[model samples]
Target: MPLDAESEAIGTLLLDRGILSPDQLLTAEDHARDWGVSLVKVLLSRRWITSDQLYEQLSYHYDLPLVDLMEHRPDDTLIRKYDPRMMNDRMTVPIKESDGVLTVATARPGPETLLYVRKTYGPRVHMVIASHFDLSWSLQRAFREQHSHEAVFALAEIDPEMSAQQVITPPQILVLYLLLSIFLLGIAFAPVPTLIVLNVLLTVFYTGNFLFKAVLVWVGGAAQESSSRAIAAEAGLLRDEDLPTYTVLVPMFREPEVLPILTQALRNLDYPLAKLDIKIVLEEGDHETIEAARSLNLEGVFEIIRVPASHPQTKPKACNFALRYSQGDFLVIFDAEDKPEPDQLKKVVAAFNQSPDNTACIQCRLNYYNARENWLTRMFTLDYSLWFDLMLPGLERLKVPIPLGGTSNHFRMDVLRELNAWDPFNVTEDADLGIRLTQKGYRVGVIDSTTFEEANVSIPNWIRQRSRWIKGYMQTFLVHSRRPIHLWRSIGPAGVFGFVFFIGGTFLSGLLNPVFWAVFAIWMIFGEDIISPYFPLPVLYLSMLNLLAGNALLIYLTMVAPFRRRWTYLAPWGVTVIGYWVLMTIASYKALSQLVFNPFYWEKTQHGLSKHTANEVAEASADVEEAKG
Candidate 1:
């Protein structure tokens, strides 16, 4: 019952029976050889043969009856005779029981499942061929969550008022109200004392925030020397036979333009198509994207998972809906516009093999494909380089809870399921999950892979995208802070310190940046004499340090970031990071406004706007291949 390369139920048998043409077989064989997939899987992927046709060929080859699982539902009594684990793990599902005989539909009739059925149901156990997808769907129907509702929970269910109140809890709101009330009373009652206290608090907070980021920047710069670069897996060292199944969840919404691009990019991946469970998760309403996907004539392996319309429609929710259908041992996410390196998955496999047992996820670096599209893009690229290329690895080294990027996060299927996958409620479910993973005594690592994405060039588009991200960060900060003591205990003091500095500091800096910039501008134009009346020497020194020293450190980090990728021309654009941060400041205020009004709103960043097309990426890929050649 072992899986044999020249099995009667597969390849040669189909050709022998004229079920497939010799040319088709040769093409499928070539794809199989290159991609490390079986001929059957390759044929299916290319739509050269339907699953039913393959099964019919299989049945003819094996001299066994072919059963359509969709036509025959398995009863509970017969299912209980043999463990569903056999069906779940072995790709075989029990179909029906007859007079002292049991029939089962099998994709692969493994020795273990065969033995179990024979022992349990006696020697009259009948084996029949069925398509893998059909058997899998049947197994799911037989045992898994019957409804999407069971799997994907909404924000309203977890917190009745969270989607309404945004991230600010009722208690936090009350506390804020009280604090504001007290502040008003204090200003009215004792203006001098109140002003002094407020100035001192602001000075301390700003100084600490500046110092914290400065240290992180320094640490990142230092960590650059100690690279966490993973060597690509040697082709022969890990054979295709040993490779585990991989799932790629690509969640898209109104992304019709990127459909063909995404499909081509994914098809170009070096991983085995047979082993890949690539789900193109689309909102049910996204007809254009769905139709576009269909128009591409994509391989059957690239499945379209239409997520049911639900309240708080988000990417994570769509991912959760798709997650149920995944058959991979490891799962990863890709954005609609992302073009990951061909060997990205292989590197992740290598990274996971080298990492410790506690490691649950590994995040790859993200950069822009159209980095030189415009000034805005150039600055955005620099900003991302600073964040992903430098700071993330530094954070990983420090053992802090790393906020995960939206895409290219590879996770162990078991661990992901244990954590209930992703928080449907959290807007930035990716980052929130990273924190959650850390708190649950798991670690996330950084891999030396990059997924290229399109950088938003338009200012209005940038604001919308940045605001949603900022809003999500605010949401995460509030959610974690709700149980400050518990979170501290879970992550420990160092973790708490990091969470506060990284999450809290990031949002706070953006929010407070404009206020300080305005003051600095006023001081620059009119001299310090006007503001010097209220500021003590110590406060003035701290303010100067926070403004000059902090901004200088950040600018330095931004400048050095591009050097990591040998993007020397982009390095000068680092100075424009200040302008970028100002944009972020504007976005932050917009985020705050939205938090009060449209909390659960997803400011969807439209993709396929870059001038760079799929052909450009394809040519780049070809160039890499040519270099290898």
Candidate 2:
């Protein structure tokens, strides 16, 4: 159906003021009809005219005073009385009250908004025009404290068991104490036997971890092919108007240089621009990137959300704060240096459409664009390819809870909100949320789409990033394991083991590697006599077999990690992953220390450091210039 008559005049006004060319107007009008959106939205989405120009013309057409909410600030007291979310949804807020009449500022200065004002604020009311940006910013400012508090404490308050606010419960501490006491007592009374038993357990654990991973790779590699093609075909057949509004959240901190790469990548997505609600979520204090985004003069589809500084300054919290202003039906997060495949969103939508009703999230494979930048980058790429491309699909196939990758995990908006969004206190909130989703009776699906990011090229940078992830895994394990029976009942037996081998084994292997390596080195130097007492004949052979076979299986798995993406060159570098494990050991210790000392501290990974990113920035600049031309 056509918009009411006043909405049609928006295009006429744009054409009359020479802000939109005749061809541009015609194209926008056609999109408006096809996409079932208003002409003003189509024009804004096209970037043919600035928001200031369109809104200025709107003020003139509607005969309402144009007020800049930023300058003539809204009444905070009045805003606090009404629901911020309701105001945001209506795109209107009561700015001030004069005598008995209330002055309202609305971005949508239409009959609907006028009726809302009269109904909500009584008959004596005045309405003024404000840009959507101004209205959103004003709402954010008024509710800064409220939103910040909610972001930090929402999960903690509503569901304490799921929150990481309390790192370890008393019962968990008691279990740890009991286990430590037993180990100490056994070591004192029967040293040799205790060592033998410890060796046996560690060897068994090593065997289980590697075998589980190998099975995952085998299962995941085979599970996704035909479904991927089917999803792609369906995506190609999807109509533009049928696609739901997608919210892209790019949460950044002090990474202004690479902002263009992300924006350009988002623009390159095959989805309709008008159907995209992109938010560049930033900390209020990060004036650098905030200014950089404004300087870019992004189209109306992109909104800059300045998150208030709060405790546990993590990406999830920033996202939760930005979630309030989001109008999209689905949401996905991308990092500053990410370059996702153009059709990734479409693929995700198709995957969701084809999935079961309970599928709440769809995880896309993540790889590195600069995989060959350095040895560290190569190893990182292989690690990610194995995790996202193989292990995740395996988890999905086995009905195990798949820990979500850092980026490109599309979520059903209602489910995300229903779960109180993300746990701000958890450092690796993505993985934790994936597990939590499964426990909550929601399934997470995997798709074939890829989002290529710049891998960490520096060893120290990689360590910092890896350590935080490990720390998060620790938090997740402790949080879910607190209620073991509930977890077992919620996810079932297969999920429990997957949780153990996947989440538990990740950190445990790192912590145990150096100990076993030391034992192996000592045995090799002393001809096995030094530790012979602790390892009887059968146990010794089992230990050696676990060491050799486990290492070989892992190396083989890494070698084939990149085959799905045809990154064969990276396969050779997989042999050097032993060095990567050493780094992981170091990071694992760092992570353990942080978990004990500062669990919620997010060790920010510095982006735009690689030479590849520099090249991307240059290319992005050229693209901007060409578009301008």
Candidate 3:
């Protein structure tokens, strides 16, 4: 839709006054078209014209008074009559009243706000424009003190990970001791027998793990029914206004570079502006990122929530802090570097619409924007493709617990809260939440939509990121396995089997990869003749099958990961993941050391490390908008 006559006149007046030049106006108009937002939004976002300047022009053009609410306080009685939430949520403040007529100051004087004022405060309403900044400042000043608790999420008090850890009962501790004692006894008294037993057990574990994933790969490849497949067809059926209120929480750290593109991607979302409740969560201490967020001069739909400095400064903690203040029917999380496909939200709504009532969470696919940045990224892409594109769907299809990736997972607000939100102590809160959801009889699903993020392209950066993940996986395993029988009863046999295979298998792959590789090296040097006597015939056969078929099947899965994305050239080189596994093994050992000493330590992944910048992600977002246009 073109701008209304009044908005056009304001633009023309701004041009005439040289507040913003004609070239700026024309360029903003072009950008407005691309972003599917208003031209006023474009100009304001670019800082071509200040909010005060634009609103001043609007008030003059429309003959409405421009008021700054901070300068004029509302009647205490009148302010108490209406809900504080409504005023804050709508960016409106009741300024003055005469003869039962109320004058309201608002940043947005659109039909929605006007209708709300008229219906709630009676038809005698006078609407005046105000600078969005001043309106926000006034709202905070008037309401923040009374309800500061409502603004920040109380995560520090509820560290679910540690709480669960402290509750480990006597019986659970006894079980751990008994198992350890049994292993020690076997090793001390019967060394050769223990070696044979351990070798056979490990071989079976590897085999089952291999077969389980092989099934997922085959099933996923055969189905090829990704969540992205239906977005185009479903977009026509669902109007933007028909969608319920949606809140997207973006938890950013010191990522100054990606902020502009982040806002651009958000503005490009295919949702109604009034219903979009997007909160950019920033740490109060990070001046660089806070300034970056402030520079965007975002719309009323986007709010900057400053999180107080606290221990366990992690993303989940930040998100948990923002969770309560979010008033959305459905909510999702996005990273600072994420450039989600424009229709991703629509896809989540549709998926929720079609799913069973027990289906509470839907995880979207996450891929790297810098896939071709270097060798590290290419392997990261292949790894992600296998996990998100293939294995996750298969897990969901099999009615097993789906370990969620951090970004792009959507949830029902009530269900999320009922589960007590993310565990602030858990590093991989996404994965841990999936397990918790399934334990509570809620089903988690996989969607075909994707959010492209910046991949860690440097080896040290990759190791830091990978080690944190490994440490968390270890935490989750120990936390949940505190009561094994209860876990078995909750998820049933398949769930228990899957938990052991998936989580246990992942940790083992990193920790045991080097050990297995060393053994293989020794075996290769000495030949089977020297190694044959120590191994029984059955152990020898199982080991040989795992060495040949099991390892090969896994390598095959990585190779075909690119084929899932139709990146055929990359698929041919996926064989290089063998070396990638070595890196993971190294990180796994590091994670093991951390888990023993500093379990809650989160090695933050540095963003914007790739040669590619956020502009590439923004260009990709624009391309989607262009295709839709």
Q: After superposition, how far is residue 592 of candidate 1 from its true place, in Å?
A: 1.6
Clashes of each: 0, 0, 3
lDDT of 3 by residue, 1-629 (tens): 45555456666888888887778878766555544555565555544555677788778766789986667665655665667657766768786789888888877666677788788777898888887666655554455444344323332345343233343457667887998898899889987787788788888888999999988877766553644456446765886436788889999888877777787778777776546778888877899988877755565567777766665677877787666457689999998888898888888888887778998998989998788778888899999999988888878777778888888999999998777687766788898888888987999978778899888888998999998888778777777777677788888888888888888789887887776787789898988786666589988888889999988889889988878778776786677888898899989999999876776677888888666875655675565445334
What are the root-mean-square deviations of the candidates from the true structure over C-alphas? 4.6, 1.5, 5.7
lDDT of 2 by residue, 470-563 (tens): 9999999999999999999999999999999999999999999999989888878887788889888898777877878889989999999899
The numbered model that scores best in lDDT is 2
Per-residue C-alpha lDDT of model 1 across residues 234-316, encoded as one tens digit per residue: 43266665688899999999987676667767877877777888889888788998898776555667777777787678888
lDDT of each: 0.77, 0.91, 0.76
Off by over 4 Å in 1: 1-9, 19-39, 45-52, 63-130, 133-146, 154-166, 222-230, 233-236, 524-527, 614-629
Name the runs in model 3 displaced over 4 angstroms.
1-173, 224-231, 527-534, 614-629
- Per-model TM against the reference: 0.86, 0.97, 0.80
Models sorted by TM-score, best on top: 2, 1, 3
In model 3, what is the error at residue 483, expressed in angstroms? Answer: 3.2
| C-alpha positional error of residue 468 in candidate 2 after TM-score superposition, expressed in Å | 0.6
Tell me how far the alpha carbon of residue 617 in candidate 1 is from the true structure, in angstroms, after superposition.
8.7
